[model samples]
Target: MAPYPPPQEAATSTLAERVGKGPDQNPNDTITTSPNCNPNGQESPTGKKTQASPTAIPEIQWYYGKHESRIAYWLLLSGAKHFGYYPRGTFNPFPITSALRRMENEILQCLSLAPGSRVLDLGCGEGHISRYIAREGSFPLVLGLDITASHLAKARRAISGDVLRGFLRQGQVEVRLGDYHDLFTSGTGIKMGEWDGVTAVETLAHAVDTKLAFSEVYRALKPGGRFCFNDYRIGIPDDVVRNESDGEVDEKELSPQQRKTLKAWRWVMRTGGMKGSEYSYAGTYERLLKEAGFVDVKVVDLSENMRPMARWFWILSLLPYAFAKLFRLEKAFYNSVSMYEQYVEWGGWAYCQWSATKPAT
Candidate 1:
């Protein structure tokens, strides 16, 4: 065989094949995992820079706080690997695969971005959305910030050679590692103002203080500049489900099983070097945005039209997760499995992408 061709599919697969196994795998294992899509069979706890963080990762409030959850962060990285990525959903006539594009387009349309609008992506994972807007849409600038150095490394690497001067044209979308929740207090140290718009995507709820995060975003934007995002965040109070929360994890209304699953996820986050807080699926985000002084908030149903896909994707993504919870393998195999699943070629989630504005003068 004259040098087997190559994966040529993705950099990740090719990189995975470079060594006998993944970076976390042991060299002692003789069994090869190349053919297996789930290649984490031999992965083990990599004591790789696990000093923990203080306010980033939500599980361990100690030494390994957020600094240890590198695996969980890969979930976001997988999405950013592709510019036109849609979180697979189950809705028909517009299944998760099809509707995701429509959903992103709807959100962009709702924002009414101009030819050269400036946008900011808070917690911009791998800067994929910003990359799309910058390279494809020709935006003026799209700045992204995060708290983890590893994520920033991947993002910076993805931006790659000449990305600043070439593909993006204006060389916009600078991805820096910083804490969005406390940017204002810390004073970003960069020239303030000149921001045309802002976005958070699926990252705002991670802040220990959602109100503070929105407030910072409010302070960062130019008047009338639009701010938008589409995350599985909490909606305004309505005829959904009754809630009686003091904003604590222990007081939520989810089933015991849900709580257990969430806890398991958090544990993995700590081990993998990512940041997350309690599930904000029930918090009052609409009211907080209003309180933060954002005008013309549009919390549309990103999932209503995709109910079918939501149900299907929920099964594909969450069933195994539920099983992990039941078997206590969440920390063992589930962590890697869930991380890998996040990279599945396609999925359908009744996702919500919201658009809000800063009141034009």
Candidate 2:
């Protein structure tokens, strides 16, 4: 383990630039949250850290806010541990499983793991990508960290029973409870600059403190360690969903159909806990990585390639949405439908694959 340099005594302007108040700000400070963001989950009414008994575990608002936890639960119930990357119609000759596996392979290639290299799978829900890394022998040591207990449980169970069990026994695979915001912090038990590379795989969205998460990743990686991820983020402004540039939105120029789509889009974002107020655009992600000392930042828009998957989800969700609408119980269903439709349309949001690296001395 290596010690981090002392915190720079800079102005807190960068922290307040996005979410108001720095990470070290008092609990009493007015911290802006997304729509429907749970106040109880942020801090106690007395502005003190909320604690729970052994029998009661306190929930942390990661990602799309409170509704995010529900989405995880539904994913588990649907037997889905992670989202799969799909090729566009041009590249759809192979089956989806093949395409997804191919995507996984590409991610590993981007990571470029060396022999006996240590890797961290940040926000590794159920360890899907982590298991793939072990099974593929991409790294001799792989650490999967997630805040979700149930996901970690499943990740451990799945890894132990799979053929990759040898890797687990060999000390090559381990899953631990950790918040991305606190990746290199002392309490996380992860060594700073210990990893050869890190893969987030659509995980940074769950970060409560995006700046801190990026800074921690920059700190945790060995110099020249690569960081890569696939993420869906805000591509356009909420008020003006179409014809946008530089994160600006104009309400007066939107078409009627666009406005309808925009409304549904907002619902999906709000319920998904995205809220668009933070660094939702692809540019914002690249900027953060650079600000955190990552170099050679690359952002590839994969929205079109993801259309096939979006279409599949839209079809699959129809049955449930229909049933829920018929019964007047379409709260979550409506959101799901909206999400799938917006994905198919590929507007107001973007699915992107990004890679960057810590500068080698």
Cα lDDT, all candidates: 0.48, 0.59
TM-score list, all predictions: 0.60, 0.70
Clashes of each: 25, 1
Give the per-residue lDDT of model 2 (tens digit) for 8-117. Answer: 22232332232122243221222233211232344422353322211112222333224634563454223234445564555342365554555666678788777557
Query: Which 10-residue window in model 2 sums to the lowest lDDT?
Result: 50-59
* Quality of model 1 by C-alpha lDDT: 0.48
lDDT of 1 by residue, 179-278 (tens): 5654532323333355677777666535544555676677777788787876543222222334422243432655565545555444534444334223
**For this target, which candidate reaches the highest lDDT against the unseen true structure?**
2
Q: What would the TM-score be for candidate 2 when compared with the true structure?
A: 0.70
| Lowest lDDT 10-residue stretch of candidate 1 | 29-38
Compared with the true structure, model 1 gives a TM-score of: 0.60
Per-candidate alpha-carbon RMSD to the true structure: 13.8, 11.3
